[model samples]
Target: MKDEKTREAYWRKNLSYLAILLSIWFIVSYLCGIVFVDQLNTIRMGGFKLGFWFAQQGSIYVFIVLIFVYVRLMNKLDKEFNVNED
Candidate 1:
């Protein structure tokens, strides 16, 4: 069995990373798309306004990137904690 310290450390690392990544996701989607939309609309991406792009496409891309980041980092973490699946 793993020691308490090791288990606690593993959970702490996992939770902290999860919180940080999710916070970033929330900020980019909500803050940029809704809160600062007017400011973002001042910038254009191709034919679409920045705010619209973010609302329709940018956030989706960011979410995909976040998923990859989580998968890659958690895979590394799992290896470090010797909990990785075969």
Candidate 2:
């Protein structure tokens, strides 16, 4: 009973984090890369156009960082809930 509720709460928190991270990923990958690309292209990132870099490279980097962030967040959440695998 209490354990089930705790599990549900943890899963809900996990899903919320997933939603937020995925939304950021979508915005960076699709919106920045394609939707506002022309506007972004007006700016330079290093030697490359900002939009091009986002489409070609930046989004991938952001995704990788987000993966780490999600892992860290989940670890903290697990600890807080006393559900950590360790």
Candidate 3:
């Protein structure tokens, strides 16, 4: 880093990204999968209750998507901060 201020900004942006992504994962896995399970169960998906699917598989799928999202966001952030390897 060229200076302390730039390094701090980069770390701050990275932490913000982590916090946002983790919150999304928490909402999907915990709120949708467990807390709102009964309400979600009213709907069906692929022969399984929506809640059950979320509790079993949907969260996993969302997590995978979020992983890609985080990677993409980080790549952009890296380029913005001129820290990208490329």
Candidate 4:
């Protein structure tokens, strides 16, 4: 934040992280859970259809994992930018 160039670079990295994380979430929740559900359904998991599992649970799990991933990434970014609270 001290320098304009640094500020811009920090913001760009932040946005890049958001874009990548959101894309992953979207692909998991939409593509795997819905778009490819039929193909996934052909597979079985613990007596449940893989596609159904994804539509109902897998996406949620992946989302939670992604959230942690984002937090970790942001924390690292913050440190790199000299903006971390710790």
Candidate 5:
């Protein structure tokens, strides 16, 4: 019973982190790329439009960084919750 409770809590924590990471990803890409594109385009980056840069390259880089961040945070969370695989 206690084990099941711990497992459930662990999942809830992990899912919350997942949701947050995904929301940030969406905001940085979809919201910034399509919604505020014109406003962003006003800013130039090495001859590349800001919106275009984000749509093409910036978002990918952010996603990569997000992945690393998630991994690092998840590891910490796992340790905190005593569920780390290692």
Candidate 6:
């Protein structure tokens, strides 16, 4: 009853975070890499075009950072919901 509802709520919140993060990943990797590449190429970043950098390195870096951020956010969420594994 209450426990099931709590679990569902937690899962919903988790999914919401995933959706937002994935959307950002897609936009950075695909849109910046290909779709808006011409526009992004006009901007230089450390000797590389912005679009090229995002395609080759920036997106990967962002994904890694997102992983850490997700872990931290989930830890806080778990604590808030009294579901911390610790």
Q: Each prediction's TM-score against the native?
A: 0.92, 0.96, 0.94, 0.93, 0.90, 0.95
Q: How accurate locally, in lDDT, is each candidate?
A: 0.90, 0.97, 0.96, 0.93, 0.92, 0.93
lDDT of 5 by residue, 1-86 (tens): 99999889899989999999999999889988889899999999999899989888888899999999999989999998887898
For each of the candidates, the C-alpha root-mean-square deviation to the true structure, in angstroms, is 1.4, 0.7, 1.4, 1.5, 1.2, 0.8
Error of 1 at 38 (Å): 0.1
A best-first ranking of the candidates according to their TM-score comes to 2, 6, 3, 4, 1, 5
Q: What is the lDDT of candidate 1?
A: 0.90
Candidate closer to the true structure by lDDT (higher is better), 1 or 3: 3
lDDT-better candidate, 2 vs 4: 2
Decide which is better by lDDT, 1 or 6.
Answer: 6
Candidate 6, lDDT over the whole model: 0.93
Give the per-residue lDDT of model 4 (tens digit) for 1-86: 35999989999999999999999999889998999999999999999999999999999999999989999999999999999999
- Per-residue CA lDDT of candidate 2, range 1-86, in tens? 99999999999999999999999999999999999999999999899999999999989999999999999999999999998999
Per TM-score, the best of the predicted structures is 2
lDDT of 5 at 29: 92
Best by lDDT: 2
Error of 6 at 17 (Å): 0.4
What's the TM for model 6? 0.95
Q: How far does residue 61 in candidate 3 sit from its true spot (Å)?
A: 0.4
What value does the lDDT take at residue 54 in candidate 2? 95
Q: Once model 2 is optimally superposed onto the true structure by TM-score, how far is the C-alpha of residue 38 displaced, in angstroms?
A: 0.3
